[model samples]
Target: MRFVLKHPEQADVEKIESLDSVKGTFTQAGQFQVIIGNDVDLFYNDFADVSGIEGTSKETVKDLAKSNQNALQRLMSNLAEIFSPLIPALITGGLILGFRNILEGVQIQMLGQKIVDGALAFTQNGAPIYNTIVDVSQFWSGVNHFLWLIGEAIFHFLPVGITWSITRKMGTTQILGIVLGITLVSPQLMNAYGVAGAESINTWNFGFAEVQMIGYQAQVLPAMMAGFVLVYLERFFKKVIPNAVSMVFVPLLSIIPAVLVAHVILGPIGWTIGAWISDVVYAGLTSQLRVLFAAIFGFFYSPLVITGLHHMTNAIDLQLTADFGGTLLWPMIAFSNIAQGSAVLGIYLLHRGDKKEEQVSIPAIISAYLGVTEPAMFGINMKYRYPFIAAMIGSSIAAVVSVGLGLMANSIGVGGLPGFLSFNADRWLLFGLIALIAMVVPATLTYMYGKRVEGNE
Candidate 1:
């Protein structure tokens, strides 16, 4: 339904009417594209400036855009604010892993085989890399052999490891000092987790971790021990003086004892639990129908998105990584998100519609651009009322292809922009390509199909 305002004193009224025919949205110049499908008019009209209480054309479009512009800028700024807290620990860990990958790659090339060859060249363009490679073999050999000599001492030191974004807060000078002081010199700490180096390693595989899984600390003993320790630690720390002032001595005082305790108690115990959890999942994944099971799991994966069951995916993924050193979830999910976004882009392009139809499709397209699919999923595609079948035809095809790719994720991250990094070095390139195919093929089909349906009032 095309609207023409007849000298309407309030131009917003004409906009309000013009967008009425949309699935539930609107577009307006110099303001946030209006979403007028619901009580949007009620909320927007509440704005004193837009309300036209004493309105005039002289009021300017800027008035219509005020609140939204503020909102958009704040969202952008807040995202920037979070970068410092998040980057160091996370990216540093990834860099270390990348270094490890480089070392492994060199070692495997020496043996003339690899667990996975990222790139191999016998003839790039036409001839051999034989002499060139042989010349560099010594360089590769140095990297390969040096990795094992002091890998942990250099790489896993708490100060260094904590530099990773995930643990940046933990690595702070203050926290480090506190942790060390309690662990060392505190006799009670030495007993709970076995004391020496070898004992520490065994405790991870057998001590607290084993006790939690088995009945070593019986039902009552386990619960009671947890409580008593918490109470004692809570009280013990309450009496302590701040150590930052004692800077020179604090590191010495805090660290020697804390390292002992963290090594014995926290790291090993956490590793044990993490390892145990990993085993349970790894066992399940590699069992009877590993591929088929993976495929089936991938199939159900899409719905977790719609129902918000996506968060639980973390544990499942942790297990996968523990078992396979990485797992298929990353690529598959990335494909899912990308395919859905592509389908939304499809609507924007192929949704030949009346002005109203165009209005709805455009904003849904906007949401998809920022990586929100629900607006497209629940609002338009499903409600397009005719092409529902076509979108599924796309999604299902994408799911099957994802299963085939054997796509794997080495580390975990979130949706949207961060997820783009997930595709790095993961074998999911094929799944990503499949998503592109799924989006284009089905989008074309859906558009052609929707084109044949009725346009609008």
Candidate 2:
């Protein structure tokens, strides 16, 4: 007789083979065929009854399952998975905003206008200033305005994308998610950005209570919580409703309760939570101890990336950008990226003579510089302990300088050399200086450490 085991174990198979009643046994995958002279039916019955072994309660099994699951890790992983697809859109919008800043924010002295007086000179502080592209050219101004269409879709209505992504990740009805997201940011409701300055908020008056007509807009936490609520409701309705009329009732049952619950309970709670977190982070970035905060954050960022905790920063960055117009935290993150890449560059130089090591190091260096550092980190830096230490030290130094000088990025952008484009126009030079430090310090330290280790060897 052949038997299939749900949770197959080699020890169980060995014990079964050792039985006196068994002649021989053959096993493949989870299935086993035993040649036995004893009664097969009796043995099968006894084995099936083993699950009822004394003193094991359902509560004990539940506790065992809970102990095995790392809830926080799973939550972070899910948040990462949900946000992965949105990164490209966010980067594109950030770069566009940066370009807009350059066109409008930077000022240049018009030397020729100073030479030729009264040539319709534009002056800032009595010096003749050259008109920016947006000022001089109607076409560029129009282009700047045109870019806002994409920016608005990506950032202002970000909740829509977040909800859709959550549905896609959770395997729910995506249309319901989309509709639910739209409700949170619909034009019928007051825009979240405008709520603070408004003299009065509009509300719907029910006989017993009143509901505020406010939108979530760019809020992340509320959309995430609401999306999951919709997902769970959809699943619950699908299970209880009959298949014949499930199409009609499931969506109706799922979306209505989900939407009501979102606006009534989850939305307010999520907003408070998101706002509180943003306030705390913003305070940390601007506090007297900010330099110390930056150093610690920069030093440990690489380790956070290894554990998948780095994904949480995406939400925080977005929140900071929404609340405070920019984020100081992301610049430090970019510096850490550059520092790790520089460490890998040191490894590449050390391994130039070895073709095999060069092949791995070259790609790792390029990837790390482009804002993806996993290759350089795990492949090169982590392999050589000194390189990782050198990177953390470099990153810490750069981050201290960043917070000290009050460096801030307009938005999240490419996280390596190109990251400077995302900085405030006035801080471009400062960002460049910090980037240089991030590169030079890590590379120099790593190379010197490697040479010393080689000499000892």
Best by lDDT: 2
Worst 10 residues of 2 by lDDT: 59-68
lDDT of each: 0.44, 0.82
Off by over 4 Å in 1: 1-273, 276-296, 353-379, 382-396, 413-432, 441-445, 448-457
TM-score of each: 0.47, 0.82
For model 1, the local distance difference test gives 0.44
- Residues 46-151, candidate 1: write the lDDT tens digits: 6435646642342344344333334644333322222334334433443344454544432333445322256444554753332222235687557646653443
Which residue pairs does candidate 2 place in steric collision?
none
Candidate 2's C-alpha runs over 4 A off are: 1-69, 111-130
**lDDT at position 410, candidate 2:** 90
Question: Which digits, one per residue and each the tens of the lDDT, describe model 2 over residues 1-457?
Answer: 4544344454365576557655445432223456443476676567558855333353343333333236775566678779998999999989988988877766545522322354666456676666666776699889989988888888889999999999998889899989999999999999999989999989878879988989998899999999999999999989999999999999999899888888889999999999999899888888998988898999999888866789999999998888888889999999999999999898887767875556557777788878998767865687677999999999999999999889989989999888988975778899999999999999999998899899899
Total clashes in model 2, counting residue pairs 3 or more apart in sequence or in different chains: 0
Question: Once model 2 is optimally superposed onto the true structure by TM-score, how far is the C-alpha of residue 366 displaced, in angstroms?
Answer: 0.9
